[model samples]
Structures are given as C-alpha cells and as structure tokens.
Target chain A: MIKENIAFKNLFVTVGTTKFSKLIDTITKKEVLDILQSLGITFVQLQTGKDFPGPKLDPNVEQLCSIRSESGSYTVELEKKITLKYNEYFEDFNNEIEKSDLVISHAGAGTCLEVLHKKKPLLVVINEDLMDNHQMELAEELENQGYLYHCTCNTLVQALKQDFSALKHYSKPEKFVFSRFLDKCIGLSDGK
Target chain B: MLRLLQGLNFKNYTPRYYFIASSDTTSLSKIKELEQSVEKHKQGEYHICKIPRSRVVNQSYITSIFTTLYAILYSIPLVFKIVPDLILCNGPGTCIPVCGLGFLLKTLFIKDVKIVFVESFCRTRTLSLSGKILLYLADVFVVQWMCLKDRIQRADYIGQLM
Candidate 1:
C-alpha cells in the first residue's frame, strides 16, 4: 500500500509518433481529470503526436514552451500549471521521461521498452483503432508477464486510480541479446 | 545493433555500424536517439543512411518504381565503399534494397559479407513483405516466434527480442 503522503505528482503522457486520439480523449475525461487532481499530480507533460485534436486548454492552466536562442541557448518558458503539446515531438524526450514519476503511453514496442528500460512505472493504453491490432497483442503479453499495466479507454480511469506501488519492478534481461547476436554475426563474418 | 557493436573489443577489426532508415520523423528521431546514446557513452563509429520511404499500401506504381530505383542507386556506392564483413538488418521495406545490395556484392563482386536478418516481433502470425523476400537473401534468417519457425524453412527461432 502506498503511504498517503507519497503519491506520484508528475506524469509523462505520450501517444507515440503516431496519434492515438482515443487514448488522448480518455485522459481528458472529467472523471480522469478529477482523479489526477485529487491524487496531487500537479504536472503533466504531454507529447501528442500528429493528428490528435488536443483537449481544450483551460485559460488558467499553465503552459510551458522550450525555445532555442540564436546562439543555441535552450530555455523553457513556464507560464501555466498544465502543459499540452499538440502534434509535435519533444526535443528532449528522454529528459521528459526522466523527470516524470509515471508514464502514460500508447502501446508501441519502442515506447514500452524505453519506459521499462528506465524502470519507470508505465501504464500502456492500447489503441484498438490501429489497422494491424498487433499493439494489443504486445500490450497484453507484457501485462500478463507483469512487466507493465495495460488498459483500453474503458479501463484507463480505473487503472490510473490503482495502487501502482504494488506493481512489479520490471527486471531487464541480464544478457544483452543484441550483443550476443552481433557476436554470432562477427563469427560468421570471420568464416569468410 | 549500434549499442552492441560499441561494447565489442574490436582487436584487429575496425567495427563500423551502419544504419539504413526511411526518411520519416519517427525513424529520424530514433536515429537521433541512437546517435546521442553512442555519443554519451563514447561508443563505436557509426553512419546513418536515409532511404526514400516506400510502401505497397497507398503508393502509386510510378512513385514506387522511382523510390526503388533511388534506394538501389544510393546503396550501390555505400555497399561498395563500406564493403562490410557483415550486414545486420531487421524486416522493413528500407532494408530490402540494402540487403539486396549486400547480396549483389557477394554474388557479383565476390565480396565476402554475411547478411543476417531478424524478423520483427510484430510478425507473430505472418511474415512481413520484407521478411518474405529476405528469406532468400539473408545468410542467417532469425524469427522471434516459434510459430514462424515452421513456416520459414531456413529461419532460426531465437525467441522474442524484448
């Protein structure tokens, strides 16, 4: 059980490089918003990919923009309390992931692996609207293996409200498979 | 593959990592991440090559032909210049031309290079278009799922990559 004083206060939301409007809409729901507010999550950094008509931004909500100066000076201007990025990629995506306590993302293999590699608490929301439906299969397999949590739009709110402290810490594979594969490739190359 | 190549003790051989990706925002960003990772770790030497994006879906025949020709022409110089000992690729449309160039070099130029192709994990139920073609080209063909092992005659099922 999570202590009352300890709660995840920062979230990194990404719909991956391709837009998943359903997942975006699910997060913006009133119930979900209320839950997020009550849980003391003060900041949400959203990386909404192309094609998502972003949620209506409240006038009072804080908006932050990272701008680069002529001499290559990077500065983040924070004006609002909440942040929303519409149809753009984050320049420092890894930095954003590092700063957040939890990640809410669409079920893409690359995105999921990145989050798990970082040992971040991740909740994968699969987009059923995809043409292939392979993301659903991958998400389910990961969820079944206790690597991460998976949900649809219908179950997202319930998932967000769950006690995530009890979830398993994803242990990365000890032996680097790619390295092993490369070794084999080198050996084969030597045969010539 | 770049990360793996970076950690190797290249005693006598100069390890050069080559990346071929389609010109798309997602692909470019991933390449950027890999570049940053290599830089941050002070890893191996690498080169990223871009290919014109082509897909069977929603593409005109003329555009497809032009893209294919462009990929082949671009890869000719790269394949000959690098003359890599091994070419490692995953199933993707972009890999088709690169792997083909490697095969051509081995067959025509008598270049000693081995091509290893790993089927993408997403292809659990079926072989992707690139995977089907690479089945004949790759010296070592690997599949992540056991279900695919029986389907591809030469494929070695290595289990899921993730």
Candidate 2:
C-alpha cells in the first residue's frame, strides 16, 4: 500500500471528447474534473476532434492544482488561459500519454486497452448510459484483470478523495495479451 | 499403428465452433441476468436458472413485416441448440429483430446455457442499408476487438466460430 506520505504530485487524467459521441456533456465533464481535484492530481484531458467546445475544470479544481483541460474545441474559459489549438496531431498527444503516470479514460475498451498496454496505470470511467452497455463491460474486465480501476463518476470521485496512491498501487501484475485475437484477425492458424 | 492414426485423427479433427448469437435491446437485461446465473453456477451454486423474456417484435402497419419477423425469430431456436458453452452475440442495435425470439425461448426452456454478445459495429463508419438495420437491433454492438475482455457483457472474442 503506497500510503500518501510524500507530497503526491504529477498525476494526469485524460477525458475523451470526440464529438463522435455526444455523451460528454457538462455534467460528465464536471464529474471527471471533480474526481481529479479530490485526488490532488495534475490533469490533462484529450478532445478527440474539433467538433464541440472544450470546458474548463470546475473553479475549485482550477484553484487547487495545475489542471489543463486541453481540447480541439473552439470555446474557452475566461478565468483560465488554457489555449485551444486546431492541430490534429498525435505526436504531442502520444508524448503526453507517455508522460502521464496514471490515466483516467472513457470506456471505449479498445482504446483504453491500447493505452493500458503502454504499462501505465489506468482508471477507466464507463458512461452508464451507453445504449449498448459496452463501456461498462470493458472497464469491469480491465478491473478484474488487475490492471485498471473501474468506476462510475460518483464512485470514482469518492475513490479519489480516499487515496489516489492506493488505487494506483492496486494495478495487477498480469500482462494484457491480444495475440489470440490478432492471430484470428490476420488469418494465421496452425493447421490441426 | 492403426490405433495411433485413429487417436491422431480425433485430436486433429475436433471441430471448434463459436456461435455469435445476436440479441436486441429488449433481450439485453435477460442476457445480463443469465451471465450472472452462469457465474453463480461456476461458483458451485445449484440449479441455476436463466431469466426469461417474451418475444414481441414491433411492426409498422404497412404490411406483414411483424409477422415475418416473428416467424424468422421463432424458428431460429428450434433449429439451434442451447447447449453451446461459449455463445457470443453481436448487437446493441438489431440482432434482436431476428434472434430475440430464439433467445427468449431458449432461456425459458433450456438449462445451463451461457450466451455472450459482441457489439461489432461502429456506427461512425456508414454501413450498408441492411447492415444499418441490423446494427440498431444487435444484442451487443462491438467496435474494437480487444474490448471484448469485459465480462457479463461478453465483449471478449473467444475466436470466430468454424
């Protein structure tokens, strides 16, 4: 148990904002921001595209830590000067992914699993209202495999308040493997 | 030598078939419940039962579409067995229109059936007209392949059926 003894800092949280899905509304964004604030984590959110506007962290969260809600949206908050750029590049994005010690992601299980394969700790927040309940299953599987933390918005917020370090330490030792699926997809099989 | 060849033939030719059962919106809850039932059975529980749902396909009054949907849905289960231990479904959109009746009947009459659904369509990519219709009624709609590791939802791909 990595107790919060030392000054716990340098934490990053990423939220997905791809206008591909309209699920990331004001309430969901605020919920994610609130959790990061409670955990005393430094955070950065990723906007998948340049469709909808990006939002600033809750005022309270902004005051407590160095939080930047990065997005490709055109909107801005007057209080914080976080810049909005129109570049859709992965160079900077991938770099940011590598830098973060912990990542909070949406329940697009494939994307999250790809991130998890990077060997960083992940706390996958699933949107409960998905028509298919796909996100819920993804997060739960990662959680079961001992590699990620899974929760709804409210439960995640409570968890952050308790201790972020404990959650980070809870990551399991098992490696996530995707070879079998790849084998099938690419048409390679031992002819038995 | 003959006995060895027979043993080898059996080992090499054992067929591995994966059935991807499609379910619709209405069947989602029952499928989830059955998943839990399977888990309990695995944990040494006795007489695990599936949650049952009735078949009802909505129809536009234009013609006999509902009747056709009912006939197709009902006949599937009769042709198929509920005994497969690994049943994968794909929907969240439209598998139910054609398969929900089968799922319902199996749950009502069968014992020890474990069915899972894989949501396999990404709506962002425009599908063919028929594909669009099926996607909407799928029991599980899947986007990424690896995301299938999730349980109760049966998102994991247990390999494509032979």
Candidate 3:
C-alpha cells in the first residue's frame, strides 16, 4: 500500500539516445497508472528520445498536447492524474533529476550512471528491442548488486510497487579508481 | 571519464578534453549533459568536433567511404592543433578515425601522444568493431571484462569502470 503523503513524488523517465517505444508504452498502462496515482506521483518528465512515438493514451483520458516556445518542451495531461513533459534537450533535465524523488529510465549506461550519481531511487526498464540488446548486461549486474532495481515490459508494475530501501545500501561509485586510471594514462603519455 | 578529469587536482599537467559529436539526437542531450557537468565543476577546457556518423554493419559502400573521408578530413585540424600528451578514447565507431589520426601523428608527424583505449562496458562476450580496429593502434588497451582479456592478448582487464 502506497502512502498518500510519501516523499516520492516526481518521476523522471528517460530512454537514453535511442528510441524505446515499448518502455513508453508499458508505463502508460492502466495498472501502472493506478499504482502511480496510489503513490501520489503528480508530475512525470519524459525525455522521449527522437524515436519514441507518443504513448497511446486511453480515449476516455483527457490529453492536451501543446507546443510551447521551447524547442522540445511539450505537455501532455493524462486523465488528470499526471502531467507529462515530452521535453527534448533542456538545461533542466539534470535539474529535474536532482529534484526527482524517483527516476524511471531505459537501461542506458549514461542515464543509469547519472541517476545513480544523484542517489535517486531508480527503476530501469530494459528495452530488449535495441539493436544489440546492449543494456541488458549492465541492468542485470546492477540489479544483482542491489544498486538499482530493474524490470522488463512484463514486470515493471510489480517492481515499481515494491519498497526500494536497498537504494540506501548501494554505495556511490568511487572516483579514485578512474582518477588513478587517468593518472596512468597521463604517465604513459608523458613517458614517465 | 569527463567527471574524473574535472575532479583532478591538476598540480602538474593540464588536461584538455576533445569530443566528436554524434549526429544522433540522443547524443545531443549527452553532449549537453557533459557540458553542464563540466561547467558545474568550472575546471578544464574541452573541444567538440563534428564528424559524419559511421555505420559499420550493413552500411552501403558509398556511405562507408563518405564517413571515412569526412572523419579523416575533420580530424586533420584536430591532429595539428589539439596534440595532447595522451589520447584517451572509449570503443565507438567514431573513435576509430580519431585513434587512427593519433596513430598517424605518432608515427609520421612525430607527435608524442599515447593512445589509451577503453573497451565499452557493453562488451561482455565479443570485441566490438571499434575495439578490434583499435587493438593494433592503441598503446595501452583496457577491457572491463575478464572474458575480453582472455580473448585479446594485448588487452588488460582492469575490472569495470562503473
């Protein structure tokens, strides 16, 4: 049971640099909608990369797709439950991530790492339809390590409803390892 | 890598980042993210070069030729102006040309730039096309997975960079 006044409100959805229509489509399902509403999520910022065709909203749901002056900023109101922002490139994307309580994204390494860096509650939905099925390995590894939660088209709603306390136990990636690697590269370059 | 570079103390060496912008829309957002992250740190200088997207698999001959030509042409100015002590690149089709340029500079132009190639984390089983090409040119090649290390003689397994 989701508390009506829980701190988790803002939900940011991103599909990395490729199109994942299936993910967008799955999230708009009626079951997922009910779960989100139960959890009191009001706003959803969807960074649908150039390829995702808009979600298929139910006929009864009132949706207003508006074009604002901003290049990739648009709003879609779904059944008076969630306000969806179909935004392109904006400075606010990271700001939105910082502000978000939970981030739902396709399993792109950059997006996943950014979300983890912010230490937000992340739910990754793997898009198997990708050209190489590239994201599956990383998503599975992270999920197995209890760093982040992952789901497929069939299991997203269940994964969403569960408590994500494991997020707190997940350690932030160490910066020193990469710095050492860079130091080594620099050393090699300078011949020292 | 950008974040790591940004956070460095830089007591001895000044690092410059050079990126080849991808034509894809998602790449645009990534570039924006990188720019913002770097700006937030307020450290280091970087350059972005735009080149034609190179498709390795199932691409027409003409397209491949055009991509190769454009990449080489775009890299010409970069070769001369942005000669760094080391060139660090990850496995991607775009990096092939850049690494090739670095190799050319090292052998012909007598530039002392060392190339470090990090295989993409996505490759758990097989070497990517970019990784395969870079194996011969790169001075130091690192792989995230042990499997890749076993397969490639020169690659060193340095655990994953998460």
Regions of candidate 3 where Cα sits further than 4 Å from its true position: A1-7, A39-43, A49-55, A59-90, A161-163, A168-170, A185-192, B9-19, B22-62, B73-84, B105-112, B124-126, B145-153, B157-162
* Residue B129, model 3: Cα distance from true site in angstroms: 2.1
lDDT of 2 at A129: 57
State the lDDT of candidate 3 residue by residue for A68-142, as single tens digits.
334446676665667767755445557878988888988878788788878888999987666567568777767
The candidate 3 chain B region of ten consecutive residues with least summed lDDT is B4-13
How many clashing residue pairs are found in candidate 2?
27
Q: Write the per-residue lDDT of candidate 1 for residues A1-192, one digit (tens) a residue.
A: 223444778888887677676666666555676666666676766676764443543233323334322322222233443333333467677888899888999888778878988888899987777675776766776676677888888988788776666567765543446555657666734322
Per-residue error (Å), model 3, residue A69: 14
In order, what lDDT does every prediction score? Answer: 0.67, 0.41, 0.71
Error of 1 at A186 (Å): 3.5
Candidate 1 global CA lDDT score: 0.67
Best of the two (1, 3) by lDDT? 3
lDDT of 2 at B153: 44
Candidate 2 residues A9-97, lDDT tens each?
33434454333323234323556554444344443444444444454345653454342334443332323423222222243445656
Candidate 1 local Cα displacement, residue B20, angstroms: 2.6
lDDT of 3 at A178: 60
Give candidate 1 misplaced runs (Cα > 4 Å): A1-6, A37-42, A50-54, A57-89, A161-163, A188-192, B10-19, B22-48, B56-66, B121-126, B144-154, B157-162
Clash numbers, per candidate: 3, 27, 0
